[model samples]
Each structure stands twice: as structure tokens, then as C-alpha cells.
Target: MSSITMVQAVNDALREEMRGDDDVVVLGEDVGINGGVFRCTADLIDEFGEERVIDTPLSESGIIGAAVGMALYGLKPVPEIQFSDFIWPAFDQITSEMAKMRYRSGGQFTCPMVVRTPYGGGIRGGHYHSQSPEAYFTHTPGLVVVIPSDPYDAKGLLKAAIRCEDPVIFLEPKRIYRAPKMDVPDDDDYVVEIGKAAVRREGTDFTITAYGAMVAVALEACEKAAEQGWSGEVVDLRTLLPLDEDAIIQSVTKTGRLVTLQEATKFCGFSSEISAIVAEKAIDVLEAPVKRVSGFDVPFPYTLEHVYMPHADRVLKAIEGVMTY
Candidate 1:
């Protein structure tokens, strides 16, 4: 095991996968020479060379369009969009081309690609950089959505995503990119299965469901809830699409109370889907209505980012509300 940050673990995953598979390639702006804006791809160019670890133009659509071609030709391409906020330019390519390739071709062609993007606020990136747009990708039918909250899951999930045959939207939480180190397994074959939720904390009072950067906030709120003589079972939803409905329901059923957390806007956020799932499938076991703690509906603010992004205090309040309901 290695105690490493998420960025290091991600670089390790890309290196390990690229070493084992020659068909796996990474392409994005500054991903090769500059090692990405967050340095997640540091030194990859030296190891894999420019051909494998490609650095493309500052065009998201071009990046995705080229990845779509690469995938169609039997190569697994992991294209980073620089930031989630900048992904809008490639929305058509992602939603129409990359995502629909396998189905449109009737299984004759599979788009084996992973669109990696850093997302969420907390880095003071202002409106142009900070955005949690996972909901948009999650709504796309043929795309697999994944978000890892820790170093271990980040490495394992990225490895799994690269190996997957279908298109995958891997959302990396920028807020927790350099979070406290964790002991990630040294094995190259280690993989955290997609479409499964990991329970970060076990409790009987309530279930606090979240993913990506919000997982940390949820855990912090859980700890605070414990101080208040309450227990919150924190669930990290690593995968969004093909969701682990059973795991979420099991946690909600066990706790009989639910509170969802997300850094995205409250209206139509991924948290709303979780809330709906619980309401439809586990309503009989509910001790209260599912409370969603999310960012404001307005565009991601610049100066008031701390106030806009959902944090431990906001989640703690939702936990208290759900428990007392």
C-alpha cells in the first residue's frame, strides 16, 4: 500500500494502465508536457511519449471528436476536458457521438473511451472554472458516469474505466484532488467496481448519501452529527449512471432516514435523482422526507463561493432536519 494523494494515485493509475495496454492513450490540453492544469498527468509524457500521452489544441469539441475516432478504430482513449465548466463546447460530441456509438451501431461498434474532467467548487476558480456538471452527463443514456471521493477509489476506478468498453464520463472532484493521503493498494489489478456505492460510515440514525467532493463534506457532517448524539451512515456514490440502487436503498432502509449532498445546483441536480429513487423504492422505510443539501440554483458565484457550495455545516443542518423529521 502507498499513502498517496488523489493526483498521485491518478497518475499512477494512468501509468500502470498505459504500461499494461498499448492501446490506451491520453489526450487533452497540457495533459502531456504541462501535466494538466492540476498536475494529474505529471511526467506521463516522458514515460509514455508524445504519441501515447498526447497534448491537443484548446478545443474541447476537437478533443472529444478525435477521441471518438480513436475509440472507433479500436483504441481506448482517455480525454480530459481540462475542467467540467469548459465541457459545454463538447456536449454534442459527448452526448451524440461518443455516448451513442455502441448503441447506434447495434453493438457492432463500441466507444471505449473515458472523458475525464475536474469539477466542483472550493478552489476559488470563479464561475468560468468551478462547476459540477455531472448531472448533464448522467442524463445521457449511453454514458457511464463515475466520481471517486478518495485516492484508492480514484486509481481503481480510473483503471476500471479505461478497461470498460462503453463510453465513460469520469468526474474528478477538484475540491478533494489534494485531500489527505490514503493508503491505496499497490497492486496493479486493484479495481473498485463501478455501479456500486461504498459506505464510508455505518450508523442507525440516518443515511447521508453523496459523491465526489461532497463525500468529504458528508463525512464531516456525519462526525458532527455523532457529536450531537446522532449517527449518520455516510455513503460515497462512486458511480452515478447504472447506479447502485440496491446499495442506496439498503442504507436508507437500514437507517430509515435520508439526506443527499451535492455541490451542484439544487434544482435537477444528481442529488434529486437519489432523493427520487429513495422516495419511489424505499418510501415505506423512510422516517422522513429525503433532504437535499446542494448549491444555490444561480450560476456558480465568484466571491460567495464558500457560501454557495454545500459544506459540512449545510449538510449537518440537513442531517439534523432529516433525523428530527
Candidate 2:
């Protein structure tokens, strides 16, 4: 029961986990002494000392590769890639090495590491700093993909990710780092289970599904629709991997229509997976075709960022279209 910013929530999670478990260590470029490029790791170096909280060279591969070694040696190392767009250089270490180590070694070696990176666009970071790379890791087996929309989930899920015995790609929507405010649980151990979605609003018209920064947009649209005599249920999908199909199916069953939104490109995005689930299992219950309101299927541009990310207007328009059908 304490209102805090998303950045502060993340800091709390890291601090709590590091104090709770001696095996937990943080590694990445400028994460220690410099406190990260985004300042998420601020004051951590002063609190945890250099051995447990480390700052390395500007190399993503080196960071991931070293985490793999550390994890195999019984240390839970969490690495932060300054931006999601810059994780490509470490894709091999993530997808090929960290992800499959436990499986290849027959549970003899577990890569319990968390790769955190800021994703999505709204701060005019263009393409290099705002790519949503969750879907990329979602496609890779043995990797857990997670995205939190608010302060509470950010703190809870980060603690859970640090404890889980797998490689987790924790995507933090940079836009909402300081945007949404909520009173997180005051309990010392308030870990939210990954893969569960939160219903932000309750309605029977349709379910607007979203995650990360887009969750706030969907909530805003739902509020506006309520003022206009329309009702819509808003779902905040906290995790991307090990998805809770039961919750999604239950929401769509009640609403009879579903609209999915994301900040990433539309083609083969996370929405595609959710839509396929509804089509495969709940087609008869759907009142209308499941629609996707997402970023255009093209490289994100600096000049057209507003056009690239889904906004409340697009979400409401999609809701209106679904209601008509």
C-alpha cells in the first residue's frame, strides 16, 4: 500500500532480491557505478557494493556470455541491455546458450538469468532505442518473456523473475516508467506470478487486450467509452510467456469481442498469438472478429512515431468497429 513510480518499483525489486538471496547478482554495462543509462540502477552500487553489482564494458554478448557462466556456477545474474534494439548482438548467447543450457545438460546446469531491457516507443527514441523485442524471445524455446504495465507488477514480477529457474527477457516499456502510479503491496514478499493478466476494467461489450505501455492507453479508452454509454473490459497481460489462456478465454467469453493492441509492428506480433488462441478455442463465443490495433508493419521512424504507436483514438475506433459488428 505505497504509491511509487515504475523506476522506483524496479529499483525496489532489485534491492529486495539482492538482499534476500546472496546468489543473486546484477551485471551489465554501466549498471553498477553509473547506475544504468536510464538510472534504474541508481543507488544500487552504493548499497550492494561492486562484487555483487557489477558494471562491465559496452558489450551485450560479453554480458550475456558471462551471465551464463555465473549462473552455471550457482549465481543468479541479471543483465541489463540499455535498450531492446541493442540485444541483437547477444541473441546467440540468449537463444542458443542461456536458453538451452539446462535442457542440454539434463538439468545439471540451469541458466537462471534475467535479461532486462527498455522497450516500445513514446520518448522519441526512434528505432535503435525503442524496439519491442519480446516476440523475438517468445519464439525461442526455454526463454520466459515478461512485460509489466505498472509499478506494482514491475516490482512483483521482477522479484519473481530473479527467483525463477530460467532465462527471462524482462521488457520494461520506457514510456510508462514514470507514467502510471499505483499503491503497490506493502508486504515484504509481494511477488506476482508471471503469465497472469489483470482486468483493469469490467465490461460486457468487448475485451481490449494489451500489455506494457499500451495497457494505459486501453484503460484511457475504456474510461472514455464508459462516458459515452459504452462498456468495455480492459485486460493487462502481465506476462507474454506461459500465457494464461484460461483468463483470456474467460474475458473474451464474457465480452464476446476482443481487440488487441501493442506498440510493436503488427505482422506476427504478440496479438497474432492471442488471436489464434481465440480462433482455435472460442470462435463460437466471439460476437465479432477479433481485431488487432497495433503499430504499422514497417520499421519505426523518428518522424512518424506518433503514427507508429497505437493510441487511445485507434483503440476507441477499434472498439466502435467491433461494437457495430
Candidate 3:
């Protein structure tokens, strides 16, 4: 086992997968010599060569469109959109082309491709750099969305996304890239299955459901709530789409309340889906209305970045609110 940052774990996964498969190719802007804006693809250019690890032009649409073609040709292309906010340009390709190819073609075609982008707030990145766009793709049918909170999940989930037989949107919470570390197995073939949620902490008063950067916030909230005599359960939802509803239902049923949290806009974010699912499946078990504490429904602010991101205080407040009700 070895302690590693989320970014380093991602690099290790790419290196390991490339070493195992000759058809795996990585392409994105500045990912070659610049090593990606977050350095998640660092040193890959040297190890995989320019042909496999490429630096493409700054066109999100073109990059993703070409990746679809590569997938059709049996080449596993991992395309990175510099930021999740920039993924709009490729929405048509992702939602229509990449997502529907296999289904629309009557199973004659498959786009086993991965679209990776860093997302979520913190690090003082303004609106353009900090949006969590997972909800957008999660609502679209035939697309898998994943958001891994820590280094171990980051590495393992990325490898699984690469090897899956369908298109996946991999959202990395850049905010916690280096803020946390964990002893992930050093095996080069580390892989975590998608569509699963990990129980971070177990308690009975209420459940704190979160993912990505907010997982840390939930953990902190649980710690604080513990002092106040509230035993809060924390569930790290590693994958947003193909959600582990069984785990969610079980947790909510056990606790009788849930505080769904995320760092994205509160209007139509991941929290909404979680809240709705609980309402439908665990309605009888809920002691209070599902609570959602998330970013305000406005563009992320330049000067108030910290205020815009969900914090431990906000999570705890919601937890207390649900528990009391």
C-alpha cells in the first residue's frame, strides 16, 4: 500500500492501463508536454509516446467527436475536456453520438470511450473552472457518470471506466486533489467497480449522502455532529449515475432521515436525484423531508468562491435540521 494524492493515483491508473493495452490512447489539450492543467496526465507523454499520449487543439467538440470515431475503430480513446464547464461543446457528440451508437445501431456498434474532466469548486477557480456538470449527463439516458472522492477510488474508478463497454463521463473533484491522501494498494492493476457507494461512517441518527469534494465536508460534519450527540452516517457515492439505490435506501431506512449534499448548484444537481430517489423508495422510512445543502442557484462567484462551495458548517446545519424534524 502507498499514500498518494488523487492526481497521482489517476496518473498511475493511466500508466498501468496503457502498459496493459496497446489500443488505449489518451488525448487532450496540454496533456502531452504540459502534463494537463492538474498534472493528472504527467509523464504519460514520455512513457506512452506522442502518438498514444497526444496534445490536441483546444476544441472540446473536435476532440470528443474524433474520440467517437476512434472508439468505433476499436481504439480505446480517453478524451479529456480541460474543465467540466467546457464540456458543453461536446454535448451533442456525447449525448447523441457516443451515448446512442450502440443502442441505436441494434448492438452492432459500441463506443467504449471515457470522457474525463476535472470539476467542482475550491482552489478559487471561477465559474468557468469549477462547475460540477455530472447532473447534466446523468439525466441523459445511456451515459454513465462517475465522481470519485479520494485517491483510491480515483485510480480504481478511472481504470474501470476505461475498461467498461460503454461511454462514461468521469468527473474528478479537483478541489480535493491534494488536500487528502490515502494508502491505496500499490498494485499497478488497481480497479474499483462503478455504480457502488462506499460507507464512510456508520451511525443511526441521520445519513449524510455526498460525493466528490463534498465527501470530506460530510466527514467533517459527521465528526462535529458526533460531539453534539448526533451519530451521523456518511455515504460516499462514488458513482452519480447508476446510483447505488440499495445502499441509499438501506441507509435512509436505518437512520430515518437524510441530508443530501453536493458542491454543485442546488437547483438541478446530484442532490436532487438523491433526494427524489429516497422520497420514492424510502418514503415510509423518512422521518423528515429530504434536505439538500448545495451551492446557491447562481453562477459561482469570483470573490466569494469559498462561500459558494458547501462547507462543514452548512452540512452540519442540514444534518441538525433533518434530525430535529
**Per-residue CA lDDT of candidate 3, range 194-264, in tens?**
99999999999999999998898999999999999999999998987888999999999999999998888
Residue-by-residue lDDT tens digits, candidate 1, 1-325: 9899999989999999999999999999999989998999999999889999999989999999999999999898999999999999999999999888888989998889999999989999999799999899899899999999999999999999998877999999988889779999989899888888999999999998899988888988989999999988988989999899998999999999999988889899998999998889889999888898999999999899999988898888988898787
Model 2: weakest 10-residue lDDT segment is 179-188
Per residue, candidate 2 scores C-alpha lDDT tens digits across 1-325 of 8898898889889998988898888889889988888888888889889998899989999999999999999899989999999999999999999999989999998999899999989989887977787788888889989999989999999999998988899999989898667898766688999878889889988898899999889988888788878899988888888788888999999989999999888889989999999999999999889889999888878988988888898898998888898
The root-mean-square deviation over C-alpha atoms between each candidate and the true structure, in angstroms, is 0.9, 1.1, 0.9
Clashes of each: 0, 1, 0
TM per candidate: 0.98, 0.97, 0.98
Output the number of the lDDT-best candidate.
1
The pairs that clash in candidate 2 are 1-186
Better of 1 and 2 by lDDT: 1
Residue 323, candidate 2: alpha-carbon lDDT: 86
Better of 2 and 3 by lDDT: 3
Q: How much is 65 displaced in model 1, in angstroms? A: 0.6
